[model samples]
Target chain A: MGEFELIRRYFLPLAGQGKSRSLILGPGDDCAIQRIPAGRDLVFSVDTLVEGVHFPKYYRPDYLGWRALAAAASDLAAMGADPECFTLALTLPAADEQWLAGFAEGLRAASDAFGLALAGGDTTSGPLTLTLQVHGTVDEGTAIRRTGARPGDLVAVSGTLGDAGAALEYLAEPAPTPDMAAMLDRYHRPRPRLELGRSVRGFASAAIDVSDGLLADLGHILQASGVGASLDSARLPVSPSLARLKGDASVAHALRSGDDYELCLTFPEDRWGAMPESVKRQLSVIGVIQAEAGLYLDGTDCSAGGTPSGFDHFRGKG
Target chain B: MGEFELIRRYFLPLAGQGKSRSLILGPGDDCAIQRIPAGRDLVFSVDTLVEGVHFPKYYRPDYLGWRALAAAASDLAAMGADPECFTLALTLPAADEQWLAGFAEGLRAASDAFGLALAGGDTTSGPLTLTLQVHGTVDEGTAIRRTGARPGDLVAVSGTLGDAGAALEYLAEPAPTPDMAAMLDRYHRPRPRLELGRSVRGFASAAIDVSDGLLADLGHILQASGVGASLDSARLPVSPSLARLKGDASVAHALRSGDDYELCLTFPEDRWGAMPESVKRQLSVIGVIQAEAGLYLDGTDCSAGGTPSGFDHFRGKG
Candidate 1:
């Protein structure tokens, strides 16, 4: 089949049944048309996952599909934007019906889970790569920006950290144990904190989704906001599974390992106190914003830290 | 530098100055935020260019940048939407300062020419790849759609056709002829007909950007609208340069060559008369919509005849 037909059959029908009114015209057009509310601001971000670099070739298509959407939507979560639509630019070496089926299923599952529509996309012949562009809408002036952090604000993170990193490690291990199934799930299917992000909009002064390690992502907020964060290593939320697995090294993993897909945010102490109990439970205060613009670990400064071996394409790693 | 820093130093500064009022916030945030005019609907499309698949490895970074932006913007033109903003998810094997500079220059040129801002995007390590997501806005109910084509409407195209294809052929030759410089330019820097698209909004019943050859692209409109087209091979606009080249084969190439980046649209005969003379002069009326849902060429049926081969990723070629 041709590339366009493959999209119509495998991807277009994957659009969720209950689409937001915001998706004016979902798929089947040159461009996906969407209508944001009059006063709302449209927020968008694009992420690309390349084979061998971003993930190994052994990954299941379904998991890759789910990961692609979740990763892209995490940006929306950071901005407190509701997912409206997304376009996929998929480049594959070859088309396998089985792989396509698995991918389409996972994509459909993601669309339904995120309450978004599968918009139009382009598919071409090339090395396996997937790029997703996610679009969402935020109420006027309500989006969380990395530059909104202020000194004295308490720094918080949603959910546990380092599980995905652990999962990656487990996968790399010979004869990986079944006990790490939950961690593997975390790596495969990250549930983006969309609802929590929206709920904390009025509360969070600054926010970012943790794709990079906790310290690395937090540093972004600090640098952008021209503030600093004092992180109490002991206060970091380490998943029980991750905590039970390794020793002090696990803490380092939580601090420096990536793929958490959780939101790290800052809020003024007073406003943080007024947040709903459930919201508060989900958000673990791990640090405090400081006047000095650097990342502090324990008492020492770990600013300009965390896996200094860069994962950037244009950097030394590449 | 890290991926994020590279984007900041090299890409972020390329955002056009005096951004559209719609752009509330640009790069640096997890997601770029933009505010659309009250009644305008947002339209977006994503296109990926792989190192070997989209272009030769030896191609210039500047040309790649321009091509990426222009190819994506062409989708906006097809929808008759005005350019707003675009995000680049660029992956590379390694950072080349010189390549980055040239690429940024081309991106800046395209952004300034099209009047759009550089929104947010993500970057990571991988083989050289570029994914561009372009966003535009069209007033509610004003955006043209392929499905809007009607039988009995006159089919027309903006600018000359098949120049890009000739250029691609020229480039593939061992010693490319400098005399075909104009064709090379078409292949290198396609100008998306944004203004012409907007101007034809109310007059044209349907439209599509000519990328995968005129016949294949027009086939999309025909299929979407459940109409047919009777194309006069002689009436099709052929550039003087293309016409002067290899006779019958050149015209055949005009019909079947991809990457033209022209706008093929349909309009009622009555409405065509109302179009500005300059616009009419630019548009070559090459065909009439037929009751039968297939394409005909100079009284000969070319329904599945133009080119049996598909240029898309999934077909036999891949």
Candidate 2:
């Protein structure tokens, strides 16, 4: 089928359901039109994932689609923006019918789950790559930013951190145990902390998603806010699957391995305490903002030894 | 260099100048925030260009950067949306500082010329590919759509067509005449008809950017509007560089080649005559919309023999 036919059959159908009211025009237009309400500011970000670099060469299309959208949407979550719409620019080697169907299914599921409409997209021929640009809205002056953290704030992170890194080991495993499957599920369908991000917006001093490992991502918040953090090595959240591994290596994954789409936020001590019980229960206090300007763990500088540098695409594995 | 460093050195600087007022926050943030005024709607479109698939492997990085932005911006013009900001997702095999510098220069030039700010984006290690998502704004209900054309409307196209296609022959010409250089410039820097698009919005019944040849793009309007068009082949405006070719082949390029980025619009005959002289001067009246179901060229069915089927990325050169 031609590009248009491929879109009509697969991607077009994904746009018909769960559309946002702001989306005046969706797919099938030269440009998608959206009308944001008067008091809301528009927030958007673009993320691209290449096949071999971002994902395994052989993988399930549906999971790939889900992972791609979730990863992109995590940025919106980090900004405390309400999910609205997204555009996908996909480049593929060929028009594979079955692959398209599976990918569409994954995309539809994620779109519905994230409450982001499929606004518009472009498809071309090339090595497998997908670029998703997500659009969202936040009340004016309410977006959580990485530059707002201050010294003496409490640093917190939502959900477990190392599940995805552990999951990578079982990416191609066959007939895995339930624990293995759960680990793999974390890698394939990492959830973006949309609700948590929204709930913490007014209370949190600053926020960023943990995609490039805990230390690395927190380093961004530190650099932007001009504050340092002192994280307790034993305080890092780890999933039951990770704990079962029972080694310092698993703890290292939580510290340095990337692809965990959890929110790492800093809140004033009083504000963190004032949060509703239900909201506060989801996060673990891993560290505290400090006066000095460098990351620390267990009273030692992090970069001095056992450095858990985060993933850098051009620089290879962390 | 690392991805973050690359962005900091090159892309971050691009965001410092020519920023739109609506841009609340730009690069370095998890998501860029913008505040669109009430009564204006947001318009966005994404376009991707892969190395070998979209352009020749060996080409000037500056021209490539300019071409990519202009091509994506054309969609906003087609919707009669004022240019505002854009995000670029770039993937490359290696981080070549020289190539990146040239590309950044071209990008900054286009961003300034088109009045778009560099919002935010992603960079990764992979085969060279660039995906640009452009954002603009238009009056809530003033967006000229492809579905609004009427049967009696006159079809007009701005500027000349197929200069990009004609420029392909001189892609690597060792030394060329001024005409050939002009052709190369046309191919490298095809301008988007933004001003004309905005001026014709209220008057034109329907509009589309001529990217996939005049015939193919017009066919999109016909399909969307449920109308057909009849054209006089001799009426197509050919650039002086194209006219010098002096053959049916050049005429064919004007009809069937893609990447022109000109505006093809349908205006009611009465409205066509009412347009300001300055606006009308730039366009050539070449056809008329018809109730008939298929395209025709001088009373001959277009698809029957001289089928200018336009460019489809997966289906090879049209």
Candidate 3:
């Protein structure tokens, strides 16, 4: 099929459901047009996932599509913004109809899950890579930033961590283990905490998505907010599936494994009890924002020194 | 160096230059924040260039960087929006400091040339790919669109075509000729017409950037606007260098060969005399938007019912 026909068949239908008031025009134009509300600011983020680097080459096309969109959308959730629209730039070595169908299905599923519509994107011939740029809208001056975390703020995380990391390990070196299969699924289908983000916006002093593991991602808030953190290693929330895989080492994996797509937020100590029930049920108070300059693990300093040791682009497997 | 350090060294400087009022917050956060002017609409477009697909694998890193940004910025220019900010998603096999330096230099050159600032971006490991999502601003109802052309409008083109196509030929099979060097340069470094887009916003009825050759790109305008076009093949503006390369089939290459990043526009016939002298010098009258339902080549119907044979992504290297 021709590029135009492919776009119309696969993308236009997906774009039809975008209900953002800001979207004056979506797709099928020289450019998509959006009108940011008078009192709102536009939040933008871009993320790219490669076939062999970010995911295993043997992974399902549908899962890759879902995970890619979820990864980018998580940034919007991190910023306390309502998901609006996304543009996908997909590069593949060739046009394979079956692969395209599966990938599009996955993208459609994630778009529906997050209430984001595909606005515009480019499809080109190249290596397998999916780059998504997500745009969101938040009330002006009300959007939570990483720089807002203050000393004594309670650092919390929505959902258990380390599951995705364990999944990655399982995918890299699969064993005849049923629990490994479940962990792989969690890694492949990360659920962006959009609802939790929206609910905790006002209550959270600062927020960021846990993409590059809990410790590494939270370190961004600490560094940006010019504060420190003291995370209780005993309080780390490792998923049951991950515990089955790594046993005691699950604590390290939960702290350092990336791609969780959960929100790590900070709230004032006084407001921790007032956190929405929805957030309360899903979130765990993992640590507290500190007054000092480094990270502490169970009252002892962690060797990594609080600097984000997440996935490094140039230096792989950080 | 790690991802953060690489970004800090190469990209942060680019983001520090706040060129647009829309940029409410720049890089170094979870996401960038922007404020679309109250009465204006945001124009968005994304383009991705993959190694060995869009350009030769051995192409200069700096040129690749410049070309990638130019290709995306061209979309905004086609829509007649003032360039704002862009987010880049880059993937590479490994982190090479030398490559990063060259890429950043090229990116900085293009950003400064277009008066755009780097807002934010993602860096990851994968086969080399650069995906850029550009945002622009246009006053309400003033943005040019491919769907706005009507019958009887004069078709115009900004700058000469076919130079880039000729450059591609030179890259694929280098000749022991100095002109071949010039052609390759044209192929690698396309200058997006940002100023001309802003200048012609009020005058042009519809517009599109010529990426997939003149005929193919212009066909998009025809299809979207529900109109047809009649081109005088004799009137196509080919560069002296391209004319030399074409020898006999100059018109064919100009029409079918892609990679030319010029602006193809439709304007009222009467506005020709009122056009700016600068535009007149750089642009030429190539055809007219017609009342008929299909395209014509020198009064004769072309294949696919008047659609010019342009590059197809699925059917490569036709």
Q: Score the docking of each candidate (DockQ).
A: 0.74, 0.89, 0.79
Flag regions of model 2 displaced more than 4 Å: A303-318, B304-318
TM-score of chain B of each: 0.93, 0.95, 0.93
The candidates' interface RMSDs, in order, read: 1.1, 0.5, 0.8
**After superposition, candidate 1 runs with Cα above 4 Å error:** A172-179, A304-318, B172-179, B305-318
Q: Rate the local accuracy (lDDT) of all candidates.
A: 0.83, 0.87, 0.82
| Two-way TM-score contest, 2 vs 3, winner | 2
Using DockQ as the measure, what is the rank order of every candidate, best first?
2, 3, 1
Span of ten consecutive residues with least summed lDDT in model 2 chain A:
A309-318
Q: Write the per-residue lDDT of candidate 1 for residues B1-318, one digit (tens) a residue.
A: 668668878887866535665787888889888888898888888888888888889789899888989988998998899988888888888888899889988888998888878887777787788888888988888989999888789999999887888786688666666647778889999999999988998999999999878888888898889888898878878888877664555667677777778999999999999989988987999989988866887786767533434322212110
Give the fraction of true interface contacts kept by model 1.
0.88
Model 1 C-alpha lDDT per residue in residues A222-272, reported as the tens digit of each score: 888988889888888887777777655567777767888999999999999
What's the lDDT for residue B152 in model 2?
Answer: 90
Q: Between candidates 2 and 3, which one is better according to DockQ?
A: 2
Top-DockQ candidate index = 2
* Predicted candidate 2 versus true structure: per-residue lDDT over B1-318, tens digit per residue: 778889989888878534686887998989999899999999999999999889999678999889999999999999998989999999999999999999999998998889889999899999999999999999898998899889999999999987888788888899978888888888899889888889998899999999988888888898899988899878989988777764555667888778889999999999999999999999999989999777887786674422345222213322
TM-score of the A-chain for all models = 0.93, 0.94, 0.92
State the weakest 10-residue window (summed lDDT) of model 1 chain A. Answer: A309-318
Model 3 chain B lDDT-worst window of ten: B309-318
